[model samples]
Target: MYKCFLEIGFEAELSTHEDPELLELAHEMCNEDVATRHIACAELRDMIYERGECNPYRMDDVFLLRFLRARDFIVPKAHRLLVRWCNFRIQYPYLYEGVDLWALVKIKDAYEGTLLDRPDIGRLSIFRFGTWDTSEFPVEDLVKAGVLMFDIGIRQPKLQVLGGTLIVDLEGITLRHVATLTPTIAYQIVSLLGVTTPARLKSCHIINYSWILNTFFYLFKRFIPREFYDKIFFHGYDLKSLQKHIDLECLPPRYGGTCNSHAPFGLWLQKIKKYRTAEFDKEMKALGYLVKE
Candidate 1:
């Protein structure tokens, strides 16, 4: 059995030997000076409100800090990102509108994986993408499913603060599966995850990939931003290489780890369903009457 460590709120045991540049950047952005950070956060919040981009919600320090850190403390850029996020929701009402939990579960299970479970030791959420029944749902529905997952992640303080990882196991994926990833769909996926959302993508590991998959990914990479491009790691079935970056204890048994027995996908999905559904409900209710003024 895998040992489970309970973490509370946004706090986690992060690495002490962080990169100096990143350490410095964190200080410059939100850690070094408390009073200055507050001032900057408040200014950005006021700017967001004044522009009438989104409905009035509590722009707490933690919330503002996410945007600030995402844009490297550039208030205008962060504000723009925040506006784009809100606008995406407004434009894609069907995606964010009345969500059906069972539908989400269907999409998730159809892929033979789950994304709602616990984070790794690095305090990063892990998504295992196994065999997917592509015919079970349209690509748009799949994209919406992704949006829902990301929405939950961005809302969670721990995920927002620390970011997450994605492990795509292509063991069972075939050319037929690759066909579903059209250029348009690829662009939409990249835009939503890389550009719109506030969640930081720590790393994306594609394991058990084939040459055909690599070719497709090369095309997909063109649509993603350069910054995010660096985070993509191709293991090609090399679990040892992957473990070099991520702890073995954090992964499921299928991925050569000990944790799967402790926290199965079903249990994790249930917890996420319960929590995300309520959060989505609250957001929709809050913005229920909001009109694009």
Candidate 2:
């Protein structure tokens, strides 16, 4: 490694500790990307099953609660769901094991109209259902399972408060960190993805936000990777704060702003597979997702 660094002419001497700066350079590296990302994950699993005990597998439902609880979680209600999720996995292992990892949870079905609805369920119910954005069990149909409080909701943030909550009016939504969306809906999005979830976004919309935040909180980590600097993305249209906050690489402010000023969004689809553009022509050949840094 030292010899390679010397050849590349990097001045900083290699050290035992790879602080955040050294570990995260906007450069491509080995077989490591979202599709492969799993350090904290492996650690957690090992912690759960003691590494050699049960293979310390990849991801299980419990990882969701562990991640969400790391930041104290959103509200008691969100925690309530998490509790049910945990117990459900234990009491009904075979039932939980049938989850299709690739599919999104039917947000309405996965969480709505179930034991989760009972205040009697509490955090335990969430544990039983799972802290996972998507429970191993998909939501049941109304015929099989009963439900109540069908249309519960939260208020959407007003356009005027965009700056406060950091909502952006996008020409289109691809991916960016700063969004003024009623962040509360995080959970709804999470349930659908059936994989990663996100943390609760602080917002004023109470009625509906809780449902969404609890749903999608895990996915947030996917957007904000180990590289914090790269995580800095904001609304391109908010010119007043553009100088103060968002730094668009291309588009300026307003309709006359810079073209192609889009912030990177969605799955980090830098590989050339789907986007056969001239730029990705070579990357696709590599068959790996690159760190755009």
TM-score of every model versus the real structure: 0.73, 0.25
- Which pairs clash in the backbone of model 1? 208-237
Model 1 ranges off by over 4 Å: 1-36, 49-63, 109-130, 261-267, 273-280, 284-293
Q: Highest lDDT: which candidate? A: 1
Single out the weakest 10-residue window by summed lDDT for candidate 2. 151-160
Candidate 1 vs. true structure, TM-score: 0.73
Q: State the displacement of the C-alpha of residue 177, model 2, in Å, after optimal TM-score superposition.
A: 22
Model 2, runs deviating above 4 Å: 1-22, 26-42, 50-167, 170-186, 189-238, 250-293
Error of 1 at 290 (Å): 16
CA lDDT of 284 in candidate 2?
20
**What lDDT tens digits, residue by residue, belong to model 1 across residues 19-85?**
4554454564334344477888888988977888775355888667767766657789889888877
Best by TM-score: 1
How do the residues 177-207 of candidate 2 rate in per-residue lDDT, one tens digit apiece?
2232223233232221211212222211111
